[model samples]
Target: MSPRDRALPDEPDESGAASGPAGARPGAHPSAGLSDLSIDLTAHEMLRRAHVLEALGPDWDPVAALRDEEAAHDLLYSGLDAEQRRMYDELVAAGVLPRRGGGHAAA
Candidate 1:
């Protein structure tokens, strides 16, 4: 390696390749994976879950709906990365999930 290439840099490594990100160390911000708290589920899956959540809003309880709605079993709870899953739960609890579809029948 050239001298310049071998020179140790002062900057902390944030690239999550090879050696892993510096923030990946224990007690760091959870994991080395990037997260903007965006839902990472597939577009189709997200849409479906949002429809389900909204359709059953207010008077609807998400837990029971998950039980009643076959597709919801793994919709928001799974097929998502850790951060997204956390955000999904928070959105559900806060009842701010998308209300694209009008009602359970609409969903």
Candidate 2:
């Protein structure tokens, strides 16, 4: 390899090392591995449970419940780095505010 080539940084293509299922060109989205789109079931279940709890208002304390939701969001982002954690928190906070209704929901 030429010295200049060695010194020059290598730029990753737009596909970024991704490839489709059939060993096709990385540019082909159809061949992207299924694992890349995998969902974390535990996190999914936790969020679902939180939603159910939110819907079951009479049985849960509003402040405490929001805390639990925050914690769950925290747990979900535990695998992420610092910047990712902030982004996750931002997403969670966006939906965490209480809904406005003039009076309590009808029984």
Candidate 3:
């Protein structure tokens, strides 16, 4: 589902306003839910691990940065939340991506 479709009950609707106060919201608390939008460790570590991974090299290699495809993918997806992963998997299953083909395809 799109972000619009996933709007919280506290979020503004088409009319644009939730029928509640600030403290009355569901996920309004700090310790409640999803407190980690800036929690992409693998991404944050990329620049720090650049010397080890050599990601900025003339020949950027995933094999060196990450052992194999699986490991590389693991690191890539390590940043995603459950909902994000689910959406990604669903898109993959549907044979579509956010970028649906700016290039020619066989079929």
Which candidate should be chosen as best, given lDDT against the real structure? 1
**Model 1 clashing residue pairs (backbone):** none
Ranking by TM-score: 3, 2, 1
What TM-score does prediction 2 earn?
0.24
| Least accurate 10 contiguous residues by lDDT in model 2 | 98-107
lDDT of 3: 0.56
* Highest TM-score against the true fold, candidate: 3
Give me the overall lDDT of model 1.
0.57
lDDT of 1 by residue, 1-104 (tens): 45555434764433333454544664466555666686666988989989987887779776776667755644535467667756765666677764323311
- Model 3 misplaced regions, further than 4 Å: 1-67, 97-107
Off by over 4 Å in 1: 1-69, 97-107
Q: List the residue pairs that clash in candidate 2.
A: 20-31, 20-32, 21-31
- Kindly indicate the candidate among 1 and 3 with the higher TM-score: 3
Candidate 3 local Cα displacement, residue 41, angstroms: 48
lDDT for each residue of candidate 3 in 1-107, tens digit (9 for 90 to 100): 46658667776554334534433454466444444565558976876887765647778775676567556555655567677767766776677843223322212
TM-score of each: 0.22, 0.24, 0.24
